[model samples]
Target: MPSFTRRSLVALLAAGSLGLAACSGTPSATPATPAATASDGALKVGIAQIVNHPSLNDLRDGFKEGMAAAGYVEGSDVVYEERNAAGDQTTLTAIASSYATKDLVVAIATPTAQAMIQALPDTPIFFAGVTDPVGAQLVLSLEDPGGNVTGTSDFPPVADQLALIKEILPEAKTIGLLYSSAETNSHIHADLVKEAAPALGLSVQEATVSNSSEVAQAAESLADVDAFFIGTDNTFVSAIESVVQVAEARQIPLVVSDPDSVARGALAAYAVDYRAQGVQTGTMAAAMLTSGGKAGDIPVERAKDLELSVNPGAAQRMGVTLPQAVLDRAEHTIG
Candidate 1:
């Protein structure tokens, strides 16, 4: 498949620190250690993504924005070669191998990061949107990367998101979970749902798939459940329309982990902003490259701002009625 890309002409870094608010997800990071290196030439940056889902796309675009803010002028101070694996493991591996000679590489999600680390063990690599870097073994620890890899993690507050499901469907007893079996990110969220569901008096019914082609059937298999919950699984999010179709047909209220999918027809979401995460990761990348720092020198950060987004029209389509309280509490509401 052809590579997915955009001309990333992001801005210079803002003058002040972009602080993350205290939250209970991944721990906030300590600032990257800096050591300046004098250079007048542009840096080459390679971005690798597992697929072209909007969340990952947002992360990519945001990374460029962060880099731009860091004072790297696109095509002048910096140049980018972005590649998307289109959900193929072989293509992802090939794409990772191709970035061996670039100044640095940004892997957009867990799978892409894993592939890149495997392909270029000695290269500077930063990952964005990875949910559990520790679980994936991408880093020895978030505070101390201990290797040539470090970046941002997008571990949404799954327990809080599960609570939102119960808030919307007070009498609902079971929520169906659809995710990819191969993704560590998906597994982490699935475990979270299982861990949190009982607290909300809800049981989880899960449907797993290995690829996008199996998505619709997987959604169909969970029709018996009262509601649907989606995570940041790249495969499922890439084929989100199938999940939406099934959810609407069955009139199952759906809650998700990010705003983009809410626009795609899921009823609501509570998630860390993808673009913000990109900027966070981008700044780290800039710090590492400009300061002659290794990836391990920077602390891995999680999203600071978590947004509650709701779409009443989507709720109606999925046969859900949102309480006015939920709508009023939303930071963003999709029409």
Candidate 2:
């Protein structure tokens, strides 16, 4: 098998110019084609994603990189038919059903995974960016999936995230939870925050949005809270700038579960590296394809590394101060 490094993948993404398109379920005109082909036969892989956010885009790139590392050359030995749902549930189901006959289908988020599970019961499915597989009922267990589905889970580092919030805002009493109620992962994170906050001497306030348009209003509704916590909820993350605007206007410190969001203006985050999660899922999918293994035989994987990201300028704008110790511990500190 060949080895593809992160540097190589970054170069590939840069050269490809992958950007978010208008909300649509159609495949991009420029699908990621592998430069090399396998000597034996090409493998057809279907990648269905929930939306075109940066984190999901990075996950898609990482999946391709992992396939390359496994000696599955795109265009040559492998071909990827990529589809994005653009945050539309109808599109998600349609995309999943379309990939029902693929050699292997990889779903990037929880909704896509659920759609694939329903649409392709016999087909192998690899899911990434899912927070709670069991809770979503996509699998029976993490250790033993017991079905034709397995992949990586982007379970937020809820405890760590709350700890970071406490470190930065010691006087914080009530932490507001901002997320979409329709997302199972959002519910999981909300429950986690509610369960974890009390021990940290903080209370939890809830604000839910059914869609992205309501995100700002929802955040504003929780103005009584001392701080805001945004989970890896796709709906909320896709419209994070709205939440950021609300946070800045209200001077409420915003903490997120995705490191990429920190770069977008959230104060800080101790979250999973989504690209790494994609690589892990893609590698597993490659192994299954190469060996003709069943998804049921493989156990679901969880993110092993968490990155700490802090933005001091965002902190100052939100009326929070990041102590020197917290700044020193951060793996990424944005300006």
Candidate 3:
């Protein structure tokens, strides 16, 4: 009988050099056979991030877990190549370009995804934490996608934000919408907030910033507002400390569209867990790869659930008192 070793068997299967039912040893008579032409070794996966943070890390970890669930175990059937931009678009583009040759690229945020889409036109791409895939030009439409990009969106329930604003500040006749004009997600969310505010007997004041350097001024410009609404703008999130500084100094409460923003400094926020979006993206990727379905066939999806988070410490600092009704209903509270 031939001496069979695990490494030799794996090599044979990986190279399509040989096929074997099982390693001959003192064991069960019937052994598991290697399926002919089965997936070679690990599927190469690339992950690109605009920056590294707890929220983004969750998405990466979730993607890993989802891949595992899809029968792609790391080191065995999957290899993850991760890159971070440290909040720089130039860096993001460089990282995305570097991963263009990977089997699959999963971009964590809007900037990274857009960079990947522009850099790797043919590579299959999955994006999470994007607000508007169509607006970003990542896809032609949510229905057919019509491209190599598809993933999940973290667009907050815009109407819900307005509703929460009204509930929290009934006397707030005019609310301020602060965001970066360049961010597609921020623009979409701002529009939604505008459309919904009027119905809630409130008016919206648009305070647009072109970049992080202007966020503090934008926040200060909206200081007179009864409430300051922060959209999911990467530029703004990157400059959250500045915004929070102005808001704190002015005693102006902030309501953000991301939980992480609240954790960082915002008074309160409603958000969808981005990591869960990563899991969703991974599942979609697995389905597409396993069935040979095109990425375009899977339309971009929205968050399945939203979480409400309140920061009482921030609220107190800004003199914004959230009613018990709202507080009790929140998924999490910090103070």
Question: How do the predictions measure up, each by TM-score?
Answer: 0.87, 0.88, 0.83
**Candidate 1: tens digits of C-alpha lDDT, residues 1-335:** 11111221011112112111111121222222222343446687888887777888899999999999999878778878877767777677778787888789999988888889989988889999988777666776677776789999888798889888888988999999998877877877787789888988999899988777888899999978999888978878877888899999999887888689988888999998998999998998988878888897787888777999998998989888999899999999897
Better of 1 and 3 by lDDT: 1
Stretches of candidate 2 above 4 Å error?
A: 1-40
Segments of candidate 3 deviating more than 4 angstroms: 1-40
Query: Best TM-score goes to which candidate?
Result: 2
lDDT tens readout by residue for model 3, 212-330: 66777788887668888887766677667788888888877888877888888888888887767778878888988899878877877887878899998898888888899989999
RMSD of each: 11.7, 9.4, 16.3
Residue 143 of candidate 2: its Cα lDDT? 73
> In order, what lDDT does every prediction score?
0.80, 0.80, 0.74
The reply for model 1, stretches above 4 Å from the true place, is 1-40
- Order of the predicted models by lDDT, top scorer first: 2, 1, 3
What is the TM-score ranking, best to worst? Answer: 2, 1, 3
